[model samples]
Target chain A: MPDVCKAPAAADALLEEERFQALSSGEAKIVEAAASRIFPTTDTPGAAEAGVVHYIDRTLKEIYPKQIASYREGCAALERNAKETFGRQFTELAPDQQDKILSAFEKGTASGLADASEFFALLRKHTMEGMFCEPMYGGNRGLVGWRLVGFPGQQFGYEDPYINRVVDLEPIAHEMPFSQQEALDGRKS
Target chain B: MAARADVVLVGIGAVGGILASELTAAGLKVVGLERGESPPYSDYALKDAVHAIVRHALHDSARHEPIARRDKEGENTRRRPVSSPTNQVGGALNRWTGQSNRFAPGDFKVFTQEIASGLAERAGASLEGYNVADWPIGYDDLEPYYTKYEYEMGITGADGENPFAGPRSKRFPMPPLRDTAKFVLFRDACRNLGYHPYRTPNGILSQRYKPPMPYAQGIPERPGCVYCGHCNNYGCHVHAKASTLYTHVPAALDSGNLDLRTRCKVFRINTSPDGKVTGVSYFDPAGTVQEQRASVVILGGYLYENVRLLLLSRSEASVHASGLGNTHGLVGQHIMAHEDVRVSGIFDDQIINGFIGPGSVGGRIDDFNSNNFDHTKLGFIRGATIGTSGSGTPIERYNIVPRGMPRWGADYKKYLTRYYTRSFDLNMQPETLPHKDNYVDLHPTECDAWGIPLPRVTFSLHENEQRMHRFLAGEGEKIMQATGAAKVWSAFSKRGSRWAGGTRMGTDPSNSVVNDKCQVHGIDNLFVMGASVFPTMAGYPPTATVAALTYRAADFIRSQNALFH
Candidate 1:
């Protein structure tokens, strides 16, 4: 219906306070903290500004309802390391100390976890999906991920095989190819 | 519940799709059984990378219907999973990458030309414990059917360009898809290296096509591909990809004599004491067991299910004492698949724009495929089909990332920005030789949610195939370097797709499960179809050959006038 008209409700929600589907207020803070350290701020918006935590929160409710408990366990793992090493919960730890805990989890050398690597992988995968997935899935707010990677954005079809030019168009957030407007849409706003 | 039909076609994917269309067109009443229901095709054409590519929403779930996997006989079942062909009405054809290629003529005579003629010996390749057999029928016999399938299925390619291709009856029905940056780079590299490269043949239509078949003309017309990068792992929003779901399945449904039954899981092939199949029993959508009696039966499921049906059909003191065709002990032998490997290259000066085109728009060289080149002193008999192809979605960035770059942090973000749009990968699917060890059998303990014993695939990369993959990855690196890439890395994965073979066809009943006619040995009315009958698979994707073989087999079954009339 309105799929073609470029519905702006998703964009408006980015500026306002967005509701979490699965994660609680405290859990959201924990995930947003980890996602920020995982893909922290640089020249462009990182996971935090891109609302990656919101993506993880919704994905937990939608596609991965089974992993909600594991995600809570992962949050506990982060807090355990933070309290042991830095005397704080994960959200309250400094970015450097948080990075240490996450990097350790990634390397599978972290303590007080059953499968740190698997949890780290899950977090990393969801982080990437949130960072890069089209804004329709509640991530990549403001098309920051597409812009950072020069991905142009989703196109139904490319009339030209070498359409690398910065062409603004709508990303097909729903099903099917929604047509390529010279190239994938790298609309920054 | 009970039903009756002249012919019962099990597994309404590629094989059954063709058989259902053909038998019904010939005026015989036909019933087709499929485990999964058909969805409106265009409904899945969603280009969502997270759902379509990363999550594999279009593919069958491994949690429920996983083919138990073990590397060798004694090893525990490993977590290594081969992507299952979807259980839906269209089968794997629903989501094939649309690379429509035919095996070289030499592929059919591997035993005579490669082994007996001393090519394998000359290569110093051992044939010990290999289950290789010369296909009873060769390329000449299937050429007409290959042409028929191609035209009917709307293949798009310049036929004469592939110098290694067997004699063609006609040009491809449509012109090939447009060449993108990746193809231009790969093609230029091949030309500079003095290798003959051809535009990849594909089932995805390049132009608005009206297929030559009378039956095909009645189905909805197909529009030309719009160069949508969503072609891989996603269905086409438009009916551009020539899947039987759009082609033959619709053709079957259109034929008045056919009954297309979806969500029906066939459990066993009912056979009389005389060893001719009586019919089949299956679970309907409501989980109620139903029987269908027929004069002729076809086992046209994917290779694993094709083998499992015979294994599961056995009962105490029944016609099948061991398995249906296991008197020869070859019902589940010589299972073959690709041992695919890859190499990725990063370009600093130029953006490849790899995300712009469908996976089909690339250059491929057949110089290394089959026996096109000399294998003298080489450690392997079969070779690989090497090409640069794939849609450059964000997920593929994992493969092309600079080796030491972390998956997280500021450096990773910069790496994604720099190399994401400027990288390309050259992938190879090496031809797998039939091996004694690389086979599938019914799992001893595992069962599905329906309590059906899961088919276990006990396959490992054969030493010959492993050696071939190693050499080919080196060649892929060389090709990538020829593209003038700034940096190159090996992105190797031993996992292959489209596991074909298990119930192989040969002339001798003592060593093979079926004959060239695709009829089970010692059983006149029972036929087993698809790539499961492949004695040796070529390096190329086998869908085109599967369609060709099914076309030929359908003709053979139609000639049995007694059953039809």
Candidate 2:
């Protein structure tokens, strides 16, 4: 008869930290490193700061298992190349140094990073999508990126008079349309 | 263990749902099986645009694999993979775009006459070279069934409204959908361009429908469409979209004679050594192997899986060595897809609201579709249906490039901002000719969790289709520009992409997998339904034809007492 919401602390983990801790150490590192380059420090918060690492972890855990498995392998390959080419861990390298290494690898002219350029590319692609994806995922919290792009959250209708016009709209929170809690507890407010 | 049922229907979608109820009414015990999960209408309405549309919840690409591909000659040797229709109740009907266009009269026999005549005039009048053939049945045969489907599903439209359409016995069941400003602009543009623009028929109910059945209990009452703009390739979250769930499936389930099971992946047909289908072996959701033995086995898993199952169930080494019902080695041949070309026009003075319309809620021009116009001067055998179907998603709607506009930066931004609300597009679904070269078989390299090779599509648009689509695009551009488009741009069609043809039905099994009744030629008890039975790809959206054929096949099965065969 106990309520799931009011129950005692089973754990003290924040959503993002819990998500990050769920990943393997190597996966966590590669996701963090790739997030930095994919959404590099723009006028707004980059991928790493927007919790791309946690987003990637949750996606791997919940979303497409097939794509996530391939993504992890791709990330590992890029890490191996980074260490082999520049003699540094991807996360430990300076931002400028990392950009130089990634760009050289991208142009396919890098000495040791040439063969694994596709791996780096895949990592960058995933990280960017994670950062800019619909905020239902862990990334883009508080609609930061969506606000930057003038996207209003899912209003069932475009009720605003200026909808047809090309005017920007304020950002809104991710409304979990269907709550699993309601299904499990068999209750609705 | 064998479970006895008077009627055993597979794939409870648009077709199966209708058939199940019909059989139940006639006092038969009907057991229907579907491979997808059974989610209620309310669950579908709560779908988010991102998760459901972009991510594809109804069509789980990761789990459902398409059929394989091979060259025409290698078709006999290749394995065919099963594709996705929902394993649950309602099947692919749950995610239909609701565009209901009847096939043109000439479309049924164009291969034998119009195309044949055009080819003769051009010194190439031979049906042997191309795979285009006449449909086993004609338009008259399915007219009544089409009406039944229209009324039962509460289709909205106007009869005698489409100048190019064939004669109808009665008017549509409901009035046309509410038109937006964008639809009006498209209608005006179409009319000014010397084209007849009429409201396209759709499955979305324009008004509420209350079924008469008292046993139709527990079915949720849905209001008319709210026009939330998520109609294309996404399940209607509201029950207003007249899918089988709100129509035939509920009627059948309400009948006590029926028992329905979901999440049952039918693997292969259980046939006797003499080539008669006895039952089917399927895997339940829990991976439990179960068999449903009925007098007949109906395969309605869309086009791909129907053909794949027939080929996979090949037995009797002498009878079906080249695959079941493929004695002529044409089970998976004549694969055709739509050749869709898009042309956009930007107007300086026009203020068309582009983002507030339904997906298929726009006017159509059938002037060039099928055999509506003469093609003697043109080098193409078939034509395209040019229409304006703007999904009107804000993120998706970018302005059209004018004829003399600069390419990028400030100039592009000027047009983008100015015509963002003032632009509409003309899109064409060109008829793709069936070719012997284009076929689907099994992929040699990849296999899914079920140990089945994914359907590999080895196809390319024929010269006739490519040239025809290009010509249609030009015609569309002229229409847009003449109708006060400040700027018009030419759009091109990609080769081999519409994805409709896999299991063709014809009079002769030599060129098709099924007969007029959509029954596999060699296997008396196995039936194939859906667009796979389409002998040639029509110029319009295949959803309506697929629906019409579904009703016809269900009626056929009922009249023949197929359940008790």
Best by DockQ: 1
Question: Which docking category, incorrect, acceptable, medium or high, applies to candidate 1?
Answer: acceptable
lDDT, residue A47, model 2: 55
TM-score per prediction, in order, is: 0.93, 0.80
Clashing pairs in 1: A152-A184, A176-B46
Give the CA lDDT, 0 to 100, for residue B486 in model 2.
75
How do the residues A104-167 of candidate 1 rate in per-residue lDDT, one tens digit apiece? 8988888999799899999888888888886766777766777667676667777666633433
The C-alpha stretches of model 1 lying farther than 4 A from their native spots are A1-16, A163-172, A175-189, B1-3, B57-63, B78-83, B213-216
Tens digit per residue, CA lDDT, model 1, B323-436: 898886788899988867878888877777787766767879988888988889888887878887757577656435657767788888777778787878887878888889
- Lowest lDDT sum, 10 consecutive residues, model 1 chain B, at B55-64
Residue-wise lDDT of candidate 2 within B1-565, one digit each (tens)? Answer: 8577765777787667767777777677887887765766544554344444434532433245544445444443333322235445676667666778888787899767775566535633233446678898888887887777676676788777788887788688789888765567777777776778888888888878754343233244556777666666557766677777766776677777878888777777777767677788888778889988888777776666666777777775546665677777777677787757888877667665555446777778898887777666577766777877556433344323556764222344344445656677877888877877777665667765577656566776666776687788888888777667777787665534435667788877667778888888867777887778888878877767777787777667777753474
lDDT of 2 by residue, A1-189 (tens): 112112121112323345453467667766676566655534444555556666667655655555665665655655666787678887777776676666665666665443556655656545645544555566655454344333454545444323235435454444652234124112111
Q: How well does chain A score by TM in each candidate? A: 0.77, 0.67
- Window of ten residues with lowest summed lDDT in model 2 chain B: B75-84
The DockQ of predicted model 2 stands at: 0.11
